[model samples]
Target: MIRGRHQEPAGERESGLADEAEGFLLAHAHRDQARREAEELCAGMPWLTTAQAEELTGHYVRRRLDVTRDLLLTTALRAGQLRQEYEARYAGLRRALLKRHAAGVCAVLVCVGGASALACLLAR
Candidate 1:
């Protein structure tokens, strides 16, 4: 039977010894479960103490928090990088096209001015 595979949020409760995994954790685990698991693991071993159990429990909680923080930091970093890339692309498109529009307008104005000047000379 499986004992240690990660369970999904919805179906974790049902993945038991049937999975053929070793060292598998229970789904919907809690702090009390942690203490119970610690108790079970240390039942036959002589090296651990009450203080050690508390320390181990605290360590587990801290490690979970650390992993969560790392995931959030990674997601934030990726989002920031994507935002910067999009902004850069938009800025480049704006820069490339803006001057062309202005140049077209200026060219039209110059053509009209030259036509007016020619008409005035012809009338002279």
Candidate 2:
């Protein structure tokens, strides 16, 4: 059963142990919270066993994770949509600015032409 156990690197073993410890702590916290919730719900009713409470807690945690994931996905999609809308608006504004600049240049040219014509008539 332990034929290749000695072949594992020391760092790998240490990391595995650390991961296990962390998982145990996290699970304990979840279980404790579950126990509290179950106790409240089970008040004035039949008591639940430790195993039952743990099972119920696991279900609660799974549902919570699913909801959190869905919320994150929705938020990310909305953010992408907002970014696209703003970018489109920025492009539209840039086009409008260029058109205004062109109109201003044309107006300047027309004024210069009128002034030059008046000077020529006066000289004649």
- Tens digits of per-residue lDDT for model 1, 1-124: 4589865655554565445353232222444465566566666666878788668767766565566568768999999999999999999999879989899999999999999999999999
* Best candidate, lDDT: 2
- TM-score against native, each model: 0.47, 0.60
**Per-structure clash totals for the candidates:** 9, 0
Task: Give the distance in Å from residue 71's predicted Cα in candidate 2 to where it truly belongs.
Answer: 0.6
**Model 2: ten consecutive residues of lowest lDDT:** 37-46
